[model samples]
Target: MVFKCQEDSFLKEFTSKVVTCTEGQLKTVIGGKITTLSCYEVVLEDTIFFPEGGGQPCDHGLMDNVAVLHVTRRGTEAVHFVESALPVGKLVKQKIDWERRLDHMQQHSGQHLITALADIYFSYPTTSWWLGEGESYVEFDIRSVKPLNLDKLEDLVNEKIRAATPVFVTVYEEGDTELRKVRTRGLPDDHKGAVRIVTIEGVESNMCCGTHVTNLSQLQTIKLLRMEKGKKNKMNLYFLVGGRVLQQLSACLHREHQLTALLKNGPADHVELVDKLQKSLKCANKNLQAVLREIAVREAACIKQQVPIPRYYSLHRKEADSDFMSILINEVGDESVLLFLTVGDDKGGHMVLYGEPATVAQLGPQVCALLNGKGAAKGPKFQAKISNLANRVKAEELIKQYVTCTTSGC
Candidate 1:
């Protein structure tokens, strides 16, 4: 219920008082009389909460020390809907969640840097940036962003970050404007008296109302997570910044420690260890598959020699998984009988019964209904989880009835 991003573009540890609150559905915030108000998110109303827009989430924190749950908008009027109700016409101080806010700022600022850099270094334009959960991304129209130049971009952004450069805003009156004259999608339809533009002193400037760091220094650093071509003439880049990068580094180190303990290798050898482990796994899996194939051949030969009994056949054992029954049933062929059952305590299984498509279609769902669980119908093989070996004889009889009696519909 948070209508974030409705206020001035700042995520400082600042506090303000609540001017009003709403109690009805929608629970909107109204300060001045309904007539004078803009009906949704206006700074003129002096409401503390930020309005939600531009894909960036709303600012969150406490209002009068109570957790603010929702910061929604009613037209241009922004409201803070909190866990604890506040009285209208009463002023309640509010604070912004700085950690979350700073992360957002870093991501927002980093995006501008990357976008500008792409235009500068790769001569590509950003199509859009879909800020993700924890991670942020910027999509560009460049087909190949080779070498990725992550380090170069990081250095360039940090230089701006370290410079502590001030960001400024300007609003242009309808007739006197040069910056707003250039447009990506063309001038906004609601061309009023003025258009707002944000500028970074020595680096770059563009039209944006999105919140950003007051001083570029707050961004610290930008760490590129990954980059890949998204579609024709498009590439997507994922990245992190400041505290988030630190957290990721910590996690990676711990994982490396775990690998070193098991592999008994130096930290720098992590790549070699991973490659060796993958190779070993592949060899082991290959050997296991060969053994399973050999076992399937021998077992099918034995089950194939069984008598052709329509609607009924079973091989019960205390320990055997589905592979045993499946091999035997398939090798027995499709023209003959159907119901083939197997029983086990440690291992669980079942096989075909009139395995024709229509028969399984009718029996499978019914069997699962009686068993109170789930199974698969693969070319007419149905399996059920039974509690004990005693269910074996009972299951065999059930299969016979289910297969032969069409009226049973199971």
Candidate 2:
């Protein structure tokens, strides 16, 4: 089914009749968890919202004031998913998110212009494209891209945009005479009806289904940010277009100002100034770590000389890591002494157990269970991360109980 959005991309709001309504599920994965949501599928006779397709995302807006969560296309039908069902045959007012629609249009048009120019200049064809929030990229079927040619392409695309060349969309019947010279990615096997051809003045004429601006000038500007190697030796070119270019430029300038003030240097000198400071910091850290190791050795020696051996020796160091704990444990080596050492801070802690094999073997699993932690053991040393620090006291008690049972055979 042909949508009204296909006719005029600028249509912001419209009244459409609800042709069909059905219940369905919307499944999404967030942070590696699959979530299923109950929704009602509302199919309209016509809509201004663009469904997700052609590497461009779906348009979001209101359907009779109910939030339209997602819009998907099944075969020829564009399905609108909402929380509540709309009454069939009822004429409802549909509103499209204008800002989002315009952004998509600008980016998509910019993509077509760039892709065409790239193919014409370097004979590099676009393999895929992705429209992201504020940024977008197109992958070309080339091993590597030269920077100078990309710069030239950027200039060429902007030149076209500045010219404000008219963009025209023409529909052609199957096996029509005018379809001879038009370039296309080919239609789907079951595709029916007339094909739509989008042309950018004399620059390009390609078959596209996505929405586009009426004029190249509406794109505002196109900036080629960078190029990187992608899968199958393809080159992926990243870019920002229209208002997003201005937004990125503003953010960059703000960051440069902050860096200049903090570094006490000009914006141009930031890279060199930061490099020098980073090297100096590295040298300082190396010297500081040496001193810390010496202090740790002395502390361990003092602890070892305890006249009456403590049943359980526990140490809580705020900044200690696993390696530092290992160094301290090695220096204060006494297999018989059960150590309950907690590293890191109150946000969470890491526990390390050092004792005789018999006691540590049983104590490691018990302490982990008591603290609701996870870790493994090697010989008499056991290390684990404690997610719940409130259980630290209880974990220490369990260690004490194990030690008493092992040493005194209780």
Candidate 3:
């Protein structure tokens, strides 16, 4: 059935009797959390609420002052999901969210203009389109789009909008001869009503079931943002229409102001200042690596020169990485003296143990378990990623006790 919304896209308020109301539950996500709400599926005699279809989201508003959470088309009926049940056969006032409806109308109407122009000027047919929450895009049959062509097309679209061209709908019953002239992607299998042809006067005529503005001027303007590669050899042209264009401009200006303050420079100099900051950071990182390597050499040298040699040595660095551990192990050079080296802070890090192969195989699993780590042994070396560095002290004590017990023949 053609809904009241489809009949007149500009209708904001209407009165309709509730035909059916059934208790139901709806699972939806709010604020990034999944929630289930007990609701009622209310079918109105006629509705101003548009059901979700043709890539446009459903309308949300109030039915007799009760929140209508969602609306969906089931065959020919528009089912309204509401928080509370409405009395069947009672006439109730239905209100539309005018801001949301206007936005959808602008974007939807703008899409028709772009689609028609692309086909007329460039022979590019629209394969699909998306009306996203933040932005929208139309997928064309071509594999790629040129920037120059996009600029030309965008100019043409806004020219038509500025001209204030008329846009209207035409309805055709089954087997109507005029229906043959309208461009369509074919009707849904369950479609059971008159075919609605949306026409942009002197531009194009296409079959559509979504709400649209009565004139091209309502779109305000259209901006082709960019093109992205899509699956199956297609190109998606992302865009903004109407108020979205103003919103994007405002957000960009806000970000530019923030950048100007942070960089202590005007907008034109932001790029140069950022480049210099990146180079400075790179140089400082290089210097830090050199100092870390020197510290590793000193640490290994101190262990090597110890009197009578130690049975085992353990060292942990909170601000180091596996590269530091490798440098320390290479400088020490004696696998006979067991080495227990760890890098990173109390949260997590890397660990390496080097010693006699038999002792390493025996104690590696025990130490890994104690530290909530995982590792594999290769010859006399055991390497692991320690997840619970808070247990580092316990792992060190275990290694020391095992070595002392072995030496004392306990």
Candidate 4:
């Protein structure tokens, strides 16, 4: 199989018949079983999934639909951290989603253009590069800006992109980066590996971890999304590149179409039409409230007529929810032997006992037990609703019972 035996480094590529995998330095096909597949880092004999080094993300791909999410290297050994189980020592082919990989390249390359433009046209030095959300941005050292020469800068940068200058990436050791007069930052002091740099012809020379396009044209187009002001000496230049610009344009067009349909107006008239519609909506709401008030006033008389006595218990509204019964009980109630009934879905309406405090207290317990209602009375006055059929007959009986209890008491 022309395989070279190694201790802790990548061995040879062979049509592995079977693999006896284990927690080894690198993924190797030995016996026939796989082991230690869940750890974040491993050593693999052959893998194209690039480890997360510098600031660039770790490359992700699948082997037989088994996802390898993160890769890490120890010494010269590369480990394949996979999500699923795999047959040990089996020869597996690799497949990568190129669209994702190329996207990272475009975003990373576009970042260099923006960072360079800042220095060349605005004298703003970039402080950081956060490659996130499949996009990247250059954070300038100085956040404050009076105004920018946007037109001139735009023309100048476009000219450079059109020039399609050759871009080169390489690794440098130690002080070689500083000696070369290329800019670098965010590197740890203890990092001993090669410091990667991207050099554009007659343009930017900077350190970065993100994968970048080989040529300037691959960056396609970079449209500045916004420049956000931050703490002292910090400004974030947010941007979109390549296909992301088209996505933004498409979304904006869709929103415009939706607004036009909703307002029943042309694009140009949308704002004015929306305002008119809002005013109409407010007037309709006002009209609705007037109607409801009229309805409530009409029902009040009918509710009072239904009451047999000049009792405190009167339904305030015909179409009242439980809240209507509750508000009526609280406002009109006095300490007297009383029963409140509102025919609707409610915990029977309020009841009260009319008498001295001592008499009401004596009868309160009997009323609560009989009507499935609750409350203590000052006189015979308690307020509750007779909502349940089991307690309906007892509603009148409880009043009579309380009458007997109050009159017979000391």
Best by TM-score: 2
**TM-scores vs. true structure, each candidate:** 0.74, 0.90, 0.86, 0.59
Write the residue-wise lDDT of candidate 1 on 327-382 in tens digits: 65666666345544544553443433436666666766565544343566766556
lDDT tens readout by residue for model 3, 15-81: 9999999999888889999999999999999999999988788999998899999999889899999
Tell me the TM-score of model 3. 0.86
**Better candidate by lDDT, 2 or 3:** 3
Query: Stretches of candidate 2 above 4 Å error?
Result: 29-33, 257-269, 303-311, 369-372, 388-394
lDDT: the better of candidates 1 and 2: 2
> Per-model C-alpha lDDT, please?
0.61, 0.86, 0.92, 0.58
Residue-level lDDT of model 4, residues 1-410, one tens digit each, is 00111111121222222233344233433476553333333344555555555555656666666666656554444456666556666677655556666666666677788778878878988777676764466678884754455555556666777888777776667567363677766565545556667788789787754466677876667777667775676987777777777777898899999988877778999888878888998999777656655554454444445556342332323234444433444443434424343343443444444444665566556655675665655434555443453554565565565566655772
Candidate 3 CA-lDDT value: 0.92
Backbone clash pairs for candidate 3 read none
Ranking by TM-score: 2, 3, 1, 4
Clashes of each: 22, 0, 0, 41
Model 2 clash number:
0
Best by lDDT: 3
Model 2 lDDT tens row, 33-79: 99888999999988888888788899999988998888987767789
How high a TM-score does candidate 4 get? Answer: 0.59
- Window of ten residues with lowest summed lDDT in model 2: 185-194
Candidate 1 vs 3: which has more TM-score = 3
